[model samples]
Target: MYRTSWSCQSRFVIHRTLVAYRTKGMPVPRPRLMLAVILFAQFVIPLSISGTAVALPEIASTLGASPTPLQWVVNGFNVAFAVCTIVWGVCSDRIGYTRSFQIGIVIAALGGVLSTFATNIALLDTGRVIAGIGSAAVLTGAAPILSHLFHGADRAKAFALFGTINGLGLAAGPALSGLLMSAWGWRGIFAAHTIVLLLALVGSMRLPLLGRANTSLRQILDFSALKAPKFLTMTLVPMAGAIGFVTFLTYLPSALGAIHSLAAGATGALMLIMTIPVLIAPVLVHRVLERTRITPTGIVAASFACLILGGVGVLMLLRPDLPVALGVAPMILLGLGFGLPLGIVDAEALAAVPAERAGAASGVINLFRIGSEAVFVALFAVILATVVTTALPGRSGQLVASGEHGHPWIYHDGLLAAGITMIGIVIVLGIVFFALTRAVSRTPALGEQLGEQ
Candidate 1:
């Protein structure tokens, strides 16, 4: 009788285990898996930005595009990215994170398909615009999703990881595209983007469909956050950083090819010097923030200092007689400048708002971040064109029309102008930083305002 009773209990235990295993319920996703999905999705945006940048000259040649139109190829994406970020952030709150992420992947893949097969410049721009919209959805959804998945200290670490992966994507993009371009041409880059995006879409299915917030369109669109001086000041750091970094990436390869006579592959290799620091600095910044307990406002000031030094380095590029190695060395400062604040900027902005309104706040900050990128790219391009047109006289059209082998002096003059423009930007940013420091000192309640959420 005792043996029979023990046997029945054993069977019951086994049965319960099987039922639990087979139960159809939302399973808690592993933290690593959750991060993997977000990181992969995040990787796509910068990869598209930097990779296409390296291939610009090739694309220009293949499609008979001039410098201005080629500028649109990059700006088209930025414009859409800026405009659609808020829309997607609202949608993420309304629909759900998983669904919004999946939709973004599909849209991005579709855009990649269009770009891969584009036969004309207009079609290419349209594809980029669509892809930009998709990127906006993916990035805007990412912060809130991570926020939902991790709490307190874990969330902080997760954001650091986010910055690390994002930095990797930005750093590796040009190098990877250069290899692909050499191996299979510019279209290969687009083809690879489509495949990776599809895989991310599949992996996203495993994620638990997180619940939606009750935020209305009006609240999401509310610009009230801008009224907070501290938050507004924090937002400008990234905007300024974006302007410097994007301008550098957009024209660096062309400048290198024209002025230094470097090939795409070589230019990409040099870019690594600038980009690699971005990969490593976030971890250090996070550690410092944790150990020293620095205010986010103070952190922003330090980051601006790094950026100012980088701007000084960029000015060094104006020296026509400088060695290529020395001219590119300033990238180290640029990388550190851009990387240090990347993780903190978003966190700081989100911290300033109510928890329920995090999504909208992210959208607003990114709008400035990416919108500045788009606007600056146009501004930089015009500066280049104007300098070239003035310096080269009637040959401006001929020089641009010459594809990859334009007059070297055009790039030379263009770089000089860009250097001057960057210096001015740095000065303005410095003034803003000074004002921010003063504002914080004067209003002791500013921290309370920022910390209210």
Candidate 2:
């Protein structure tokens, strides 16, 4: 009896010691409410970007900015968003997710207010660029911020929520832009963004910090955490995915306009059609696919295939009769291609490094994607400009002073550019995905046999 009691006591002590060791920096095990708020903030960053895109014409006319420089309004935010992600990621690890995120909200508010008073295009872009910086700060901190709030199954759920919210924000931006634009015009949009920033700031402050006391800049970021191979793939695959996506979204709007003569509501409807699949994928992934043991590489390879099919599908829309709705068919596949990679890549990216450094990993990935976004956005714009400048004016354009003469040929400059570029991405993604897929597996045989399926 004595021996058994002592042994039991010893085991109890050992178990408690292990638990203590596990909880070192983890203050509270999980905070679901905080995760919810963090995801809501995630909703705002892309909200601003997509919202602004829908309101571009209004912004240009209100500011007296011409069509060419107007692209900067959109570019400015993205540029800052892309550039600041890495910096904020490192900062979050050093400081604390809550504090870093608050700082971001404050910075974004300042940018919003400043943008309202700009007299010229440069000033406006400057304000947007400033806002972009803040936007980057917020996004960079979001994933890392939530790491402590979840782990294991909860962590997967948190990521799914974050991704779904993000997809919704992007999909909703256009419609929200239209609503805000119709009601308040250009300045109203800025005012709304400022309001959003302030609200997020206030809401962010209320989030209980899961017992975190770390408030150092180092909490926001750290450089040493980025040596992992999975982290590298996380960064590159997403960028490649972003390039594929940016290629389509870049030209898709115009393609619809030319092919279907889709009006504003119709365009939003088409985007809705594409985004629906994205939202569904996350849920299905959580409920169904998570049950199976699946490799991230296999999923990404599937995504690459989706990109290829989506690109080809869009090119097919160039046909006179789309049979189905405009962009409905192609967008279905495109969203599959775009959504799966984004879902898997980002989730894995966060899981790749230490929870402490997930933000930094996110930032590294953002750097690659942002760089790609800039290049592709510019490339897409050039395509549009080429088509617009060279095409002959329509009868409707004769009525409007601002309307440009669009290309006369079927799939003229911009459309053709989009088609070729998308196909190029399809090929590049195929090679890179296949090569990378093989590298990660034990044997090349495990990787999907190219041309086998």
Candidate 3:
């Protein structure tokens, strides 16, 4: 009887073990490995975005493309990234985050293959677009995977790493691209990019699954958050920066080449003055928030002031009379202006709405943020090209816009026109931002607002 009882208990324990294993789904990678993979993937997306700017001159020279088509090399990526980010966000919910992220890596690697071998400008831009779409999936899938993998303090740390990795990529992109371009020419940059993506893809294969999809949470795009005036105003801050700063960031290498006749290596080194602040300013802003009582609104106001000055300061480059060193100060100012309110505004915007709508609010704000970048950057390029056409007309104007060696005087009118146009937009945005911030009461911390939920 004692032997029979022991056998029954052993069978019962084994049965429970099997049931628990099935309930938890398939075994996955250890959490630490997953974190590393997610962070690695995050780093490359922004690297690809900002690094490609350094390659534009080479692409132009190699393909002999005109200005308008050349602009698409950058714009095609931005527009595709902006649109696909939303699609990937929704798809992650249905197909599981791990799968979505793996698919993204595969697609991006394929795109890099195309980019590495392309002989024509059109083929190159198409590769960039495919890469952009894949980048969106990686970004959208990261947060969900991290959220599921960690809890409380660990979760916060994981996200902090996420943000830091993004900033690092943006900071390091141009310099790395320049190094590769110098060593093996432009195709080397894309080849290195492809290699990195393939490594990420291999790592992703080990990621633990997040179980079956949660189809019950399906909801369409929600814009109910836009009704709040304060939220709307806060959203405009980044949009303003997108117009005032990102456009300049993307095209500055070309501008430098045009004005100072610098080579690709030198231009990339110079861009560090602008991008390094973007990497560090968020940390500075966080410290200031903790140590002082300065309001988010005040911080934003200061950001606006910096952007306006930075815009005007960049116009100094258009003058043949000013020293090139003067450009450094404005570049730092623009970087600070964009970086000061980086993560703060997103939290503040979400805090403005009801707790339940926080997710929707985030989606709305991101869409606007990306859409503004796509629209304004395209506009900036078009305005610059149009002005150049009017001044020089036909092929000479096209060549100058494409960053071929040209007299500094030829770029003066085009740069001046584009600079002034951006400044005017920033000023108008500032006026609206200030008015709306005053209309609302001081915002509470996001943690405080969302505590009940």
| TM-score per candidate, chains pooled | 0.82, 0.73, 0.83
- Summed backbone clashes in each candidate are 0, 16, 0
**Backbone collision tally, model 3:** 0
Q: Which stretches of candidate 1 lie over 4 Å from their true place?
A: 1-28, 91-94, 214-225, 283-302, 318-320, 343-367, 389-403, 450-453
What does candidate 3's lDDT look like per residue over 1-453, in tens digits?
A: 123322343334334434555687744344567789988877777677567767777887788657767777777777787788879977888888888888888888888899899999899989888988988888777766665555433544555576556556655677788778888888998899899888888898777655433222232135544555777887898789778887777667777777778788888888888787877888888888889998788788888888889878888753566777888899889888888887687767756665444444555665676567656766777887788767877767777776655756777677778878988999999998888776655665434444454
- How close is each model in CA RMSD to the real structure? 7.3, 8.4, 7.2
Per-residue lDDT tens digits for candidate 1, residues 1-453, read 123322343334334434554576544344567679888887878777655767777887777556556666777776787778778877877788768888888898888999999998888888989998898888877766765555444555566566556556765777788777777788998889889899888888767666464445455445677777667777787777766665666566667776666787787787777777777777788888889978666666777777767767766663447777776567787777778787788787667676555655655665576567656766776777667656665534434422245576566766668657865786697687678757856663433653564
Report, for every candidate in turn, its global Cα lDDT versus the true structure. Answer: 0.70, 0.59, 0.73
Clashes of 2: 16
**Which residue pairs collide in model 1, if any?**
none
> Would you list the rank order by TM-score, best first?
3, 1, 2
The 10-residue segment of model 1 with minimum total lDDT is 1-10
List, residue by residue over 395-442, the lDDT tens digit for candidate 2.
322111111223223434456665677568657757865665456554
Superior by lDDT: candidate 1 or candidate 3: 3
Which window of ten consecutive residues has the lowest lDDT sum in model 2?
A: 396-405
